[model samples]
Target: MDNFLEIETSVKRVFNSFRHEVDGILDRKLTGGEFRVLSLISSGVNRTTDLSKKLDVSASHITAITDSLVANNFITRHRSEVDRRIVVLELTEEAKEFVASIEQKKKEMIVRRFSVFTEEEREQFQELLKKLAEN
Candidate 1:
């Protein structure tokens, strides 16, 4: 129990640190939730229902995030061709470029953060994270 609690605290601290770094890198252009939604959309998770399920968020929450993305020209929605009742989300060309840039910046940041670790240590750490995620 104590070990689990320690792990949880460490995870929270790491997540908070990463969020702060990314937020600064993004210049506050989007919230973490918004960025996550956009990233998922870019990865082909389009429908609001799908996003809600994937993110474990409410449908209305996804709607609000999509609304902001639409307003910023980051993404656009259209009715699905096969099902008019279903709306699909897509990233605009500009948004694609923006996301790519953001991804590059994030990669750079991660590389910098992990620079102190040896290659084997980093690989082991990644494996451990994957194992935890699988659980």
Candidate 2:
């Protein structure tokens, strides 16, 4: 409604800056897509097909991302006990710790960034963001 491109760019910058900041803190790099996949897996979307569906990506695309995660020792893939055809993905212990650390850092960063706003303002901002995100 108001310079849509500007709003889009600003949103992109916010996420990219957070990722960059986290990358610096961790002394490593991860693509936004990779981090998202890790987050989803951590949150209980374990099946490969399910992840593809949730992310709206193709199965092969998910596999490529998971393959890198596996190679990095961040995740492990196994066949479902009940259904060997389905591939289950789990974060390695190291990945759990890594994700926890990243979450903590992100929480602190967001808190600091939003500190300038009053509590009511923060709540309104959150609600507005959610409204914008609604389908």
Structure candidate 2, residue pairs in collision: none
Best by TM-score: 1
Over the stretch 1-135, how does candidate 2's per-residue lDDT look in tens digits?
Answer: 979999899999988887777667566656667877998999999988899999999999999999999999989999989988888999999999988887788789889878999999999999998998994
Where is model 2 more than 4 Å wrong at Cα?
1-16
For residues 15-110, what per-residue lDDT tens digits would candidate 1 score against the true structure?
999989999988989998999998999999999999999999999999999999999999999999999999999999998998899999999999
Model 1 clash pairs are: none
Report clashes for each candidate as comma-separated counts.
0, 0
